[model samples]
Target: MSSKCIVYGYMFLNVKMSSLLKRALFNNSQSIRKTAALFCNATRNHWNYQYQPGPYPKTPEERAAAAKKYGMTVEEYTPYPEDMGYGDYPKLPDIGEDSKDPHYPYDNPELKRNFNEPLHATAEIFGGDRCDISIRRRFSLLHQWTWFLGTLGGFALLMVFLEDYKIGRPVTAKQIPGQGVHYLFSPN
Candidate 1:
C-alpha cells in the first residue's frame, strides 16, 4: 500500500513538472520569435542603401525630380571631354621641366658626386652611421615587474570573490554556513 502511494505521488509530481517545463519552453520560444522580428525590422530600417531605388537615374526628369525633392539646386549637365571615353580615365596634369627644384641643381658637380657614391656611405653625410635608429624602452624593468605583480594579485582577488565554493560539496561546520575560504586547489 505504501509503495503504491509513493508511485502515485511521483507520477503526479512528474506531470506537474512536465507541464511547467512545457509552459516555460513555449513562452521562451514566443519571446525569441518577437526579438528576431524586432531585430529584422531594425536592420531593414537602419541602412539607406537597402531602401534606395538605383545607382543611376533612369530618366533625365527622374534625376531632376530627385534633386528637387531633396531641396538641392540642380546644375546643368555638361558632356564629358571628347578625348576621355565614359570619363573613367582621368586627364593627367602636364608637368613641365620648370617644376624641378632650384636648390638641387641637375648640372651641379657636388650633386653628381653624391649620386655616384654608395648608399651606405651616404648615411655618413647625415649624423648617424645607420639609417634607422634603435627603439628605447619607455618603462624600467622594476616598473614592468610591479605592473605584472599588481595585475596578477588583482585577478587572484577577483577570482576569490566571484566564484562559489560550496556549489556541489556538502556543507561543513567550520565553513561558517555561508562564508568560507575557497582555495584554488581542489583535491579531486
Candidate 2:
C-alpha cells in the first residue's frame, strides 16, 4: 500500500476507536442497569420503614392543656422580630399615611354599618383572591427513564456508523487468504 493509504488507514482506525470508546463510556448499559438497581434497592429499603401514627390527645381537656403549656394562646404571644424593642434595624413606617391606598375595603362606610357582620364575611376578606393558583402537576418517573434510554440508543447508532465508515464492509474469503494465499507460495 502507498503511504497515503497507510495514513488513511491509521486515521480511520483512530476515529473508529475514539467513537467506539466514547459510545462505550456514555452508553454502558450494564453499568447503567447496575446503578439503577442500586438506587432502586436503596429507595425501597428506605421507604420500607414501619410507619405509625402519633398518639392523639385522648380528650379535649388534654388537648387544651397541651396547647396552653406550649404557649399557643394569643395572650402569651410576643411581637414579631420587627415589632420587638428597638435594635440596630431601622423602624418601618406605617403605610396609613405614606401610601396612596384609600384603605378601600377597611375605610368603606359599609364596614361601620356592619359592625354586626358575620364571622364568615371577615374570613372572606382574608381569603379573597389570594387563592393559590400555583398548582404542581406530577409527571411519571418512567418518562425520564425512557428519555435516558433513547439518548443512549442515539449515541450507540452514531458509534455504529463511525465504525462502519472506518472499517469497510467485511472482506470476502476470496479477497483474504483464499485467492492470494495459494499464488504466493506456488513459485511457478
Candidate 3:
C-alpha cells in the first residue's frame, strides 16, 4: 500500500477505536446511566402526550368544557379592587415641638440633651470621664520573630518535599505498541 493509503487506514482505525472506547466508558459510567434513566422517566408522561391540541376557548362554557375534556379543573378569574385616587388619602397631623413625652420607648436621655452635637465631639462633653487613651504594645518582638520563622520553616519544608517528589514523564502513542495515530489527538 502507498504511504498515503497506510496513513488514511491508520487514521480510520484510530477514530473507530476512540469511538468504541467512548461508548464503552459512557455506558459503564454510573452518573451518565442515572441521568439518562431520570430523563426517560421525566418525559414518559409529559403534558403534550396527555393533552390534545385544540382551538382557543373564548367563553366560560367553552373553557369549562376544554378543562373537563383535559381532566383539569377551571376556576373563575377575579381581579383585585382598583386603587383610589392619591388625593383621597387623609392629611397627616403636624407634631408640636413642645411635646415632652418621648415618641419611642428606646430614646436615650443623653440624646435629648444635645440633638445637634457632631458625632466626633470628645466623649468628656457627653459627661464621660476625661481619661487618657494610649496604644499599648500587644505582641513582643520575639513573638513576632518566632511566628515569622515558623512560617518560613513550613514554606521551606514544603519546598523540600516538592523538590524530592518526582513526576513521571508523559508517554506518547509512538512509545506504546498498537497505539498508532492516537497521541496526535490525545497525548494522555
Cα misplacement distance, residue 93 of candidate 3 (Å): 58
Predictions in order: lDDT: 0.51, 0.47, 0.52
Candidate 3 on 20-100: residue-level lDDT in tens? 878867778876677679887856774663333344555778666755654445653211122432211122122222232
Instruction: Report the C-alpha displacement of residue 51, candidate 1, in angstroms.
Output: 5.0
TM-score for each prediction? 0.19, 0.22, 0.20
Instruction: List where candidate 1 sits over 4 angstroms from the true fold.
Output: 1-23, 26-55, 76-188
Question: By TM-score, how accurate is candidate 1?
Answer: 0.19
Which is the winner by TM-score between candidate 2 and candidate 3?
2
Listed per model in order, the count of residue pairs whose N, CA or C atoms clash below 3 Å is 0, 0, 0
Model 2 regions more than 4 Å off = 1-56, 68-139, 167-188
RMSD (CA, angstroms), candidate 1: 31.2
How close is each model in CA RMSD to the real structure? Answer: 31.2, 32.1, 34.9
Best by TM-score: 2
Scored against the true structure, residue 168 in model 1 reaches a CA lDDT of 70
Q: Compared to the true structure, candidate 2 yields what TM-score?
A: 0.22
